[model samples]
Target: MRAVRFHEHGGPDVLRVDEIDKPEISAHEILVEVAGAGVNPVDTYIREGATQPFTLPMIPGIDVGGTVAAVGDGVSGFDIGDPVYGTGIGKNHYGGYAEYVTVPDDRLVQLPEGVDPMVAGAAGVVSGTAWRALIDHGNLQAADTCLIHGGSGGVGHAAVQIAAASGANVITTAAPTYHDALTDLGADVVLDYGRSDLADAVRDAAGGGVDVILDHRLHEYLQFDADVANVGCRVLGIGENETGVGFERSSATRRKDLQLTMMTMFNTPDLRVPLRKLAYLMSEGDLEISIAETYGLEDAAKAQQHVIEESFLGKVVIVP
Candidate 1:
């Protein structure tokens, strides 16, 4: 089997495709013939040594969409040739950037009929993160006014769709070019994040402030988030880390009784919880998965570079 492995983290160039022994599954795992794998920001973080990966000589991928070639003895409800998709790859274990990868059965979800495997791969982390932030953390209601930052990116795009489907009035930020496309995806208002008065723009659109904010670009918009949150608003942080940014936490806390949620899927150990709901939504066409680019499995390095340098509109996938 061929796999992408990085012995030491530095840059995209560190990734190399090499012949490796096929992974042997544990009793509760499944062997998947890799079809597609999603690339995310954390993939780069691990590659660049920004985050401490569980192991070295690592295959860096978190989500996959593929056919089950075989299942371990302890695995049931899934069998040979079943199409499935889910997360739990490349996190202290082998991932989908190869000819074959082993995954725990619990982390895999059966794909719905007619859902593209590439789309399923893209939905794993980004869509699940969006679902966690808005529905799980924010507790968004139908009449809520919600602001989604970085709306044209992977998680942001999913956030827009989810908020709109829940009947919330959706406001999003992106480059001016993506405004029309975002509106088509159910955003009630799209604001250019480059604007100096973005807080005012959000306020104007949502009648003075919004009830929930999904802030992907946390450092760039933390203060603005504070300004635009309505009374008792929920502010969920997805991408940014708190150590880099400093703001007046007391004011937001005292003034609006805001609830701040900083999240990563790793914070919750169970991948199955979000995967079930996300799979159902994808099956029903209630959620959309966007693929910004697809590269051959051997081009994993190039794929990682694209994720870092490009302001791509959605997930970048590696098709093995």
Candidate 2:
């Protein structure tokens, strides 16, 4: 089996494709013949030594979609040849940047009928994160006006659709080029963050301020988010700045009595439920996963570099 391994943290240069032994599954785990692996910013951070507590020769990826190749003892409700998709490895074991991956039975969901494996892999982490942030934590409702920062990116895009499907008014920030596409994805309004004051734009779009905010660029947009949130609004911060930057004190949030929360997708103990919900949405055509690009398994280095270079819509997948 071939896998991407980083013996030392640095840049994309640290990733190398090497032939490694296939992962052996424990009694509670299952072996998957990986079809696709999703790449994310955290993978790059781990590669660059930005995220810590990882050992050398680590395999870097969490989301994977594949077919069950073998099942370990005590694994029930799933069998060989079942199509499954969800977060894999990465947390405490080797991850999905490989030909085969060992995954705990609890973390995966059976792919819904007619769902593509690539799309499932792409939806794995981002969709689950969006589900938790907007529905579980933010408590978004039908009457709420929601502003999603970086709406064209992976999690943001998913948030837009999820919010819209729940009957909330969805506002999002993106480049002008993606505005129309995002609108089609359920964003009621799209603000060009590069050209306009996001706070003002959001306020104008929502007729004063929004009821909820899904913030992906925390440090870059936190104050602006606070400025444009309605009184007692909820703001969910999804991404963290790498530099540990601080925000200036402001009376906007204080005066409004806003509720702000920061969330890491991994903080959610289990992804099985969220992934199943997202899978149902995908299967029903109520939601769609955007895959920006796909690369060969051996091109993990290039894929990670692509994620670091610029903001792209949706996810980048590595097909094994």
Candidate 3:
């Protein structure tokens, strides 16, 4: 099997493609033929040594969607040729950058009928985060108002749709160029995050302040999040760490009785939770997944570069 691995971490140039041994499955794991894999900021973080440390050689990617080439012992209700998707690939283990990868059955979710693998690969991270944030952490209610940053991006678009589907009035931030797209996704308010004063703008759209704030860009918008949050409202942040402002305990703990949630779509025991809901939602037309673009497995460098540049709106995928 060919996989992307880097011996040293520094820049995108470190990514190297090489022939690697196919992963062997544990008793509870499944072997998936890699049809598509999603690129996320954490992929770059792992690749660049900004997040967790790994062995000298590593393949970096987050999620995979493909047919099960085979199932391991003790794994039931799943068989060969079944389509599935899930996270935790490149984080604690080897990920989907290879032609084939092994995944724990608990982390794998069968793809819904008609859900494309590439789109699932693209939707994997964002949709899972949206579910954990809005439905699980934020305690979203139909009458509540919420805001999401980077609305046209992967999680942002999914958050908008999920919140709206849950009956929450959703406001989102995007480059002005993506306003129409956000609106079409059911965003009641869409603000330009590239401009200054995101808090004031989102606040005005919500008619005062929002009950929940879902932010993908934490550092630049932390203080702004504090400003726009309604009293007693919760603020959920996904992925951003180590920088920006207001992340300090003193500042983040300041009044409005705020609840700050750090969101992760992986490392959960109940992997079936979001997968089942995402399946039902996708089938019911209540949730949507979007792909910004696709790259080949060998183009991993460009994909990493794209993450650093933040030039893409949604997940960038590598199709095998």
Best-performing candidate as measured by lDDT: 1
Candidate 3 or 1, higher lDDT:
1
Instruction: Please provide, for model 1 over 1-320, each residue's C-alpha lDDT reduced to its tens digit, 9 standing for 90 to 100.
Output: 98988999898889999898888889999998888999988888888888767898898898899899989999988979888898867877777888888999878988878888767987888888888889988999998999999999988998999899899999999999889989988899999999988878899999988899998777877777878888899999886655676465656556877788988876656788888888888888878887889998779989988988888787799998
The list of candidate 1 runs beyond 4 A from truth reads: none
In order of listing, the candidates' clash counts read 0, 0, 1
What TM-score against the true fold does each predicted structure earn? 0.96, 0.96, 0.92
- TM-score-wise, the better of 2 and 3 is 2
Q: Write the per-residue lDDT of candidate 3 for residues 67-99, one digit (tens) a residue.
A: 899889989978888888877668777888778
What lDDT score goes with residue 246 in model 3? 62
Model 1 — which ten-residue stretch has the worst lDDT? Answer: 245-254
Total clashing pairs in model 1: 0
